[model samples]
Target: MTRNFNYWSQKGVKGPSPSPMFGNILSYFITPRPHLNMQWQKLYGKIYGVYNGNKPVLMVAEPELIKQICVKDFHIFSDRNTNRRIHPILSKHLVVETGDDWKRIRSIVTPTFSSSKMKKMYPMIRQCLDDFIVELDVYAKDKGDVNVKIMYGNYTMDVISRCAFATKTNSHKDPNDPFIINAQKVFAPKVSRALCFMLLPTFVLKAFNMRGIAEESANEFFFNITRHVMKTRSNSQKKYNDFIELLMNAQKSSTNNNTKDVNHYDENDSSEAHHVNEGEEEKQVENKILSSVDKYITEEEILAQSWVFFVAGYETTATTLTFASYELALNQDSQQRLYEEEEKQAENKILSSVDKYITEEEILAQSWVFFVAGYETTATTLTFASYELALNQDSQQRLYEEVMTAVDSKGEIDYDILARLPYLDAVISETLRLHSPAIILIRQASEDYKLGDTGITLKKGQQLEIPIYAVHHNEEFYEKPNDFIPNRFLPENRHNIKPYSYIPFGAGPRNCIGMRFALMEAKLALAQVIKRYRFFRSPNTDVPLLLNKSTILHSPKRINYPFGAGPRNCIGMRFGLMEAKLALAQVIRRYRFFQTPNTDVPLQLNVSLAIRTPKRVIIGIEKRL
Candidate 1:
């Protein structure tokens, strides 16, 4: 029953001691997973080992080693351990696939999230934001304190649904919406806790026929939605610029795929019927059908992709907005600086035109990826920034002044202008250091690799969990690691931040795909908010945040930090951030945020829920004059 997976020490990798029965499981379970990883990094060494269940896990924090593992030698560590095989469809998405399959899909989808493509999606988000602002005003009128998590979550869901699925239902106003209901049902932690993936190898779990993922009927319904959408698109002559259109286009193109050979190969080239021996060519076509990537996207595949988008994009931003608003409510001095300022506009040169679309399976996925990762990650960081600012007014005011001095009106934020607010950038960075929502940069070793000159070698199948939380909080890298100090990220102080130690978005080749998007969004939103409303510490503001025990993935995503890392990092990071910035900017422009008696101070994370989250963010808002 007890085992110590001290493979690191056996291989001469110096690090922390592991317990026999649970290895580091208990440690990770009690504290946040990232914090746990950091603890071992500090107590043992930046390079060490701990057991993940029964498996040996390398807890790497050293920048140089991190650089190598995440970048230079990514080939050997390309696969991730988190695979969902129970679901027939969900498992097919790029997030769950490994090796060449992952590569093929990633390529098909990457272009959809490009700058031009995202510009097309922006209007959808803006439309959702407009509704969100109106909703906020309604809440501000009669509410004691509002639950921002719910508010923003619905807003993001509405936005992603329209842009990614090309289907719309008012998730905020309509609780009975089938899409929202079914979306919540998928990947429910209740099903997972009963039959955990970590308890055994993925294959073994698959062998046993465990239903850790959503049930079959649920997936069937989900599939039907996408199927209907695709059928409608194909039969109709209507044209839309959203993700569905792109996917349908890609799907239609792939229907005629004919692999290139020597001198000639065209997707529509069925001339083999005219030239080649029919029987032999037919047999060869059969092999290719089974071997190569699916020439055409399946309805199930498209639905699965759609589901992933809904799941990933919905909950994240709502939580982030909640935290951002809550923090602003708690820090009045910072809020005051904003009350004295205004907004600004930007030029249209920043926008672009899309040249191509992506595979339907990929189209749905990338659209969701752009929406969710961009929406939630940045929102969460803004939440932490607000929290930190409320508690640390000095930093908050400095940021508010920057926003005030940078922009002149309530219009689009120029990219160049957003870049000018260094203090706003610092606040975002510091907030990421203290909070990062997604935890760790996970990479799996593909082959035996040496750990620098440390004489330690990691064998293939072994996992590396670079604790973003620990690295960000390491005292060696950050003085008073626990404090909220934006100056730590200032231009003069940024160099002191050691290369990998400050990887909120990770480092090297496999860093977050949406890093640029997230930063831009956060900067714009914070600037806009500071230009208008003042954030003050409310009675409900949590002084020292507490994480819940039964968190779905790992510790509470309540704080912020880590958008993941490596070749498999979050793909739609840019979209999420853009939505966040746009929404936050709009929010602050309309009203001032404050705390109320119903707010939960020293906020308690939800113990019963699968995801680690604040129980509630009940913040008050007043209309700005």
Candidate 2:
């Protein structure tokens, strides 16, 4: 234990002092994560060390160092932090996989959120958004305050279910829906449990078989549902375009021929081509496959990926929506401008838009990833957008105008029209900046590596964290970092910003794969919502917004862009943006949103797994005059 505590000191790394068995864990618990991180950076400079129990973590914030770690020297830091003690259901997915395994899974999953796939999946997302509007209508008619968080959660859940598995829950109308209940449980705060996973010895945790961050029942629920979906789909003759089908298709392609291109191009696909290895031969095991050569994913891996997507997409997207709306609500000028733009140019309707073969477990996992990743993040984007628009009315109105100006001569809204709107893009980017869903980007050293020109050396297996929120808020990187300024992201002003300084989804090879999908979903939702309604603060609304104590990250995070950076960036970034734009366009075109007595002035937030989401965002809405 003494040796463990002396690890950082021996290396001559500067950091806050650790005490006893808890190390710096106690300090972490008492101080807000964002504030504490800032203090550490100010005190120890860009690179510092901290202990989570006796395990040392090197915190990196310098852009140059970050660039090297995430891009130039990626091979040495290819994997994110992970706990082997996590349940198999959670450990096998793309988010947790390491080294070659991660590379292979990523290759197989990259195409799943291709622009073409997102385009095809738009209708499914639109249908879900349409349901979302209907749900909002109840409050719009009563002139009552609506809770955007809960509402967006339902909408995102529906989108994931529909788009991922071709299943419909209409969660917006049925809050008690089993899927919603289970998903909520999966994201429910488990601070103590998570702490244990961080502090306890790996052997102790393995002996106890700790489930890590999620509830066993919820994990089982998702697993069982995924399995059932896979079975039902496999037994049927019907061909459907969804995530499960795509994963199945991947399986067929893999099993049929190992020599097939892992990064094969589809003429219909619009996403960037994934890098291909010329002559790497892949070997396949009976149930498990490694890298793109083998081109096979096990049932457990599939299930794990699905679980990650669900948890990843669900809260993150929904949280983005929540904050966007909150900000827009507080700034009615932005909201009105966005609304007018939508009314003048956006079409009357918002547009919305996958297939495959293979094992019941494999099928289920694919379906799960779609639902998990697709649903929450998109919904969260909408929720945050609504919140932001309510706060920053001018930005909202500007976005609305962009939406309106982009409409076709016949006032028809389509993927192309929405995709091209710059202000809408700026508004959503700004929203993500101020309240990025991902608080930090994590990496682990693969070998003994020395800091750039610095005497400090990181031993192999050292845990590293890039303080995303801290960097985003650094005064050096962003002027008035706490202010909600969309102009910083505008095409004209974007060049003023620096690279590796704005990572919401993350950067490098291990960045979020669903980024494009999440952003598209967010932009679509924000466009539609701004067009139809204008969000305003209500009595319940938190005027200044107070951060939750237990949340992992806090403070205002600003960035010039929102879709991550470097080689790993967000694959679904385009799709997520499209979805968000479509939704925003559709909503703002028809309704006006404003603050009601019940709105939470300084929105109350809570941590849901990896996302920091509002408990509720109550705002008044009315049909556009």
Give the Cα error of residue 116 in candidate 2, in Å: 0.6
Task: Please state the error at residue 392 of candidate 2 in Å.
Answer: 1.6
TM per candidate: 0.79, 0.87
How much is 155 displaced in model 2, in angstroms?
1.1
Off by over 4 Å in 2: 1-3, 27-31, 258-293, 340-377, 407-412, 549-565, 568-572, 595-604, 607-610
List lDDT for all candidates, in order: 0.52, 0.63
Give residue 498's lDDT in candidate 1 (0 to 100). 66
Worst 10 residues of 1 by lDDT: 268-277
> Model 1 scores what on Cα lDDT?
0.52
List per-candidate RMSD values in Å.
9.7, 5.4
What tens digits encode model 1's per-residue C-alpha lDDT throughout 20-118?
655656554556554456566767877777676667777777766765665556667666764445655566554555666565554444444555555
